[model samples]
Target: GPQIHRRTLLLTAYSGPVFFHILFYYCQAFIYGTTFQHTASQILAFTLITLHFAKRIFETIFVHVFYRLTVSFYSLYLYLFHYWLLSGVFMAYYIYYPGTCSSSISLLSSALETEETSLYFLSAVWIFAELSNFETHLILANLRIRYPRPIPKGYGFDLVSCPNYFFELLAWTVITLITRSLASLLFLIAAGLHMWRKAARKHEMYKKEFGSQYPKYRKVLIPYV
Candidate 1:
């Protein structure tokens, strides 16, 4: 299996949306405005999605420490294709094709507009989760730099072994709440399940490294969930 740099992999994953979504929106707004009307919901959704990917790209380069983390090219391609492109298609269908005979798609736009107060609250929660996740990554990166066995503690990490994953799940949960998109909800569920399994594996590794010293109260992805 040929290996690819984690940084390269992450950059590619995020770059897909930054490139495709922007182009998609531009064409929909300027080039094809006669065919597609740009609504507030679509603009907001696009901003939120693009900002999410931009934050990821920034964090992958500046916050996370790649170290010797190299994954197979197949794994990279799987993630890039499944998440970046496929997810974009799902989002585009809901956002851009509102008049395409789907009541559910029409409902998504209405949900965002109708739930103004709830959306604002959820946006705050999302921002907090994003910052918390970034802070957790910084803690882990610094721990690695200091050559210490990484034992995440405090903040979101006080309860879950993978607080970053926890916050990530929360962030997506908020996004689903704001957009009310079935596609994003489904994606969140799938990603949360995958993160849960990975967190359990990581917790076991911590146990192997620290033995009884590992936090016994710490759960895997969520606390007592």
Candidate 2:
């Protein structure tokens, strides 16, 4: 397929959204003409997104290597919609909603504190998965350097063809649970579907490229599904 420059497309996609989130988050008063206090949960949402996308920007420039194969304009649209548009909702609607939706789970009610506990647990999981994803990318980068092609081996690789996708989904799942936003759910669905297709495609590629040496039992994106 005809494609754009990988680094240029990725930098634009990731950096644009990160800039939007930071601007909307801090400049709430200037944009909306009024300012409201940010709940703990809202802060967490903003922080996690910033960290996640910043990591992506860094990975795009330094970590991931792109060669002949490249993506279409669809990726540009998908990144903008997922990271920019839906994340705009996180800034404009979800965070500054001035309701329970924007408020911290711990402050909602007696049982809500337990929700915050789960939020903490989820955050931990997200961090772990993010690190693991980075590690996988490093592995791939190294492989493409000296080897014919990349073959993921460690972490969640033995189980899923794309553990990075699984980890990405898991991190987003945590974000959705923490923010409890419908827009976030929509983002999750959109990104998850795209990743599912990509995972299946890559799985087939590995099978054809590596033959029976590639793990036949390895699933696409998830273990059971």
**Clash counts for all predictions:** 0, 0
Report lDDT (Cα) of residue 27, candidate 2: 86
lDDT score at residue 123, model 1, on the 0-100 scale? 69
189 in model 1: Cα distance from truth in Å? 1.8
lDDT of 2 by residue, 164-213 (tens): 89988888887877777887888789889889999999899889899988
Model 2: per-residue Cα lDDT at residue 35: 81
Q: Highest TM-score: which candidate?
A: 2
RMSD score of candidate 2 (Å): 2.9
TM-score between candidate 2 and the true structure:
0.87
lDDT of 1: 0.73
> Global CA lDDT of candidate 2, please?
0.78
Candidate whose lDDT is highest? 2
Local distance difference test values of all predictions, in order: 0.73, 0.78
Number of backbone clashes in candidate 2: 0
Model 2 segments more than 4 A misplaced: 1-3, 69-75, 89-92, 100-116
